[model samples]
Target: MRLIIGGGTLAGKPQLLFIHGIGSARTSDVELREWSTSLANGARAAGHADLVSGLTQSWAAETRFANYSDLFYRADAQGAADGISEEELPLLLALLEEMTQELGHQAELAGDRRSGDIIDSARAQIRAAVEPDAVQGQGLFAVVRRAGNAVTTLLQLPGLRQASQWTSGVQLLPVLSQVGRYLARKEPDDAGQGLDVRIRERVLSGLDPSRPLIVISHSLGTVVAYEALHMYTGRVPLWITLGSPLAMGALVLQRLAPRPPQTPAGVERWLNFWDRDDIVVARPRLERWMEANALGVVPVTARADTHGLWTHTATKYLAHKDVAGPVAETLKNL
Candidate 1:
């Protein structure tokens, strides 16, 4: 949103690109501007004063926001303008159902009745979240209410939560379900909603291939960014992901373009930041599942700004030194 282009050239300065994830249709240019400001302020807070002023003077305007939420929202715009659509509910419900079913099946297979009960409880909560009267379409308040209801329901499922931590593959079910829904959602052909192609195209269009790239993506945007890297034959010197779910295992990783390599192609370094309390990022140590050395997970303290899963917010993710450190490193390299 803050495009300060065409100034004196800062040769070899990596362009910083921000790609937002889901539930971001309402995000305003002001919020994006604030995020860029925070990154600069964060850099200063992290004792990178030289990097801060160097970036501000040399390439302040080079940062770009690859906003795709409006495009994503348009695809599922059948409900109240401020709330999740009626059509979206079914798709989301299906994901929740599938997750519960998978967990239930796994519990059954393991002869864990306790976990099965928890799965059933989770299923009920998912059902409750989409019920006809589950969420009043009053306004943003209602949307918050609906999300709160769903989150509360899930949080109460101790069995499912316990089993997920104890079981190797179970923790991935919820993460997979969310990723599955994003990948499977149907949009009008002209809407350009598919992640690997359409969304990736939107992300790539804002990129300047010649410049070194430092990609900062949040949530589902990380998925799209990763795909775009595989499709585009350009170099990304730094790939930073905030609250990404890409480490959720086979359901997501195995299906990635370039087929889940040790490190993404064209990416010299990858820094993934995750808050332990952020529900969106199920697994953060991507290197454990993939290759080593290139990818590192930096855990940050989650801020409980509000109830529910807002811990995944970009503002909180961007406020940390762990995140700013990598950006400083990229700028220092330049």
Candidate 2:
């Protein structure tokens, strides 16, 4: 991991920090390259040649990634034979239940009755798959396996699969497991510090109160960034969250660190982006749920559609002009 002792800024340039979501076990340098490339591509798509040039050049020197996924790594590789741990099971179930409900609601909004039926059927299948008596003869592992298969089956459904672009239950399970481990706040590293605390510390370390900072976070990282900003004394000119689950009431919203959720005092403006087909997103509009902070900073939520099958990917969201345009504009003004 690259340490930013004096803050992320280089010379007088502003700092841009990227906080990634779940399943990012790769090195920070590798992720920085990938994320920077995506952001540059996005700026190009937004017709900001200057921003693209800057990102491709010295802007990288000023950028930092809050890499915390290393803390969640296990001796057994992800998606291994061990399956989801008992501690992570409840969180996964809660997330899946909430996802199904949101999917049904989205289908209704789109007037897609067939999709709604498919979601309802999948919900029933999941409920039955996890029932104690359903797998009485089998062990707990059997129950988890069946539940995972059911969720995968739902994703593979003809319509839903095409819409979501995510077909592997194997891939989804690990992502949910990591997210669960963080939100459950029960797991600790070898040092005895809570995983949540450690993860937030990683984020806080990248924050430099001395510079004009812009934070761009995705998925579960949004949760970490949100909490870290609350604890930070610096001010952020812009904050962006993509495909976040913060609106997943029971599983995420209620479990946030601060008592009642509000825009972090340090943030001046917040932009939240979501795709209707992104299964990770429960509700697209965060402004409706999170209260404005003392700075009167409330999230301005917008839809940035990525028609790809898997709209949840950070790169996919970054590539959208609607999403990238704002970042470029903010940077230009800064």
Query: Best candidate, lDDT-wise?
Result: 2
Tens-digit lDDT track of model 1 for 1-334: 1323457564554688888876534454665676676677668867876556544443543677786665543434444323444444444455445445654665577687875676577667566656666555444335334443444444444322333232322223333233554565455355554534666667788577777778888888888787777666667777888877676555456656666445665787777777644545555656566553244322222322222234556767776766776687666665
Candidate 1 Cα errors over 4 Å, as ranges: 1-6, 26-28, 53-61, 75-148, 154-181, 191-196, 292-309
Model 2 Cα lDDT, one tens digit per residue, 194-220: 889998998878556877788899999
Q: List ranges where model 2 is wrong by over 4 Å.
A: 1-11, 76-82, 130-138, 157-167
Candidate 1: 10-residue stretch with minimal lDDT:
297-306
Give the Å shift of residue 281 in candidate 1: 1.4
Cα-based lDDT at residue 55, candidate 2: 72
Instruction: Give the C-alpha miss distance for residue 41 in model 2, angstroms.
Output: 1.8
Give the whole-model CA lDDT for all candidates, comma-separated: 0.59, 0.78
Among all windows of ten consecutive residues in candidate 2, which has the lowest summed lDDT? 1-10
